[model samples]
Target: MPAAALKNKPLPTQSTAKRSVLFDSPYAPMAKHRLPAGRPREWYVTHNRRLKAMRLAIALLDSGVYLANQAHDETIRSTAEEIGVHPPSNTTCHMVRALMRYSR
Candidate 1:
């Protein structure tokens, strides 16, 4: 516990340390997390909408669609399909454009 004892301790070797799969492969698929139960139905709806919007926004950005006006509802929906997600609702499309607008 003393400073002298700490200074005498040898650094941990790789064999002694725990390794994370994420560290070995940064792009590895992550485990899905279960959402807590007992929340209102509206809460889940909004949560999923936000996630869909975020994914669409990122896809648009990656595809070189920078401006909110440039990202039409059809475009966002098509991107969602391309990314293997169901087509988003109009409200989700609006949220995606808002995300793009505010990201600037």
Candidate 2:
């Protein structure tokens, strides 16, 4: 969409948590470590996945593991757990792909 055509449209809402675990994931700019007051748990749940994924991606990057393809998905998940991000979900995996894309 043209920038002029997109004027007045609301940007998508993002997480507002206080991210204690800092990293260089692309999503780092948006992810926080704690939910803002008054936000519903449901809202937090929806947004926190990206933060978790960001942490996992940072761990992989630190380990020199750049994603090559889906073949890297399992490695990503294991890294997630090793880094304390348990039960890595599909959304987290998607974020990992995104991180790798930007890095490349």
Candidate 3:
């Protein structure tokens, strides 16, 4: 296909585009917002708290699982229970599969 004949994807769904701020076209002026100086939102704090707890759970895996690089298993059970976040699916297959992939 020729570059001139290519088509762009439609605008993403809200949940997908909400996190992006960059504009792709010269004709599209960026949306401007004036945030009041100082102070962050309560929801941001709660989000950070969950992220911290998730990182702690990943660190706990170091003793038993030998996952390569920064490949953290997103599904953590015990730490999730302790922190009162969503519980992982009650399965051990994820770790075994991760190990099998790394060995090859």
User: What Cα-based lDDT does every candidate model obtain?
Assistant: 0.70, 0.59, 0.39
Using TM-score as the measure, which candidate wins?
A: 1
Q: Cα RMSD (Å) per model?
A: 14.6, 14.8, 17.5
Looking at model 2, residue 60 earns an lDDT score of: 67
Runs of candidate 2 exceeding 4 Å displacement: 1-34, 40-42, 68-71
Model 2: worst 10 consecutive residues (lDDT sum): 12-21
The clash count for each model shown is 0, 7, 0
The estimated TM-scores of all candidates read: 0.69, 0.56, 0.24
lDDT of 2 by residue, 1-104 (tens): 78896665342223122222223333323344655789888788867777677677777666566654632656666665445556677777887778767876
Sort by TM-score, top down from the best: 1, 2, 3
State the lDDT at 58 in candidate 2. Answer: 70
Deviation (Å) of 22 in candidate 2: 19
**For candidate 1, lDDT tens digit of each residue in 10-104?**
33223211221111111222366887899999998999789778877977787678899888777776666556588888999899999999998
lDDT for 61 in candidate 1 is 82
Candidate 3 stretches with Cα past 4 Å from truth are: 1-38, 50-55, 68-75, 82-104
lDDT for model 1: 0.70
Clashing pairs in 3: none
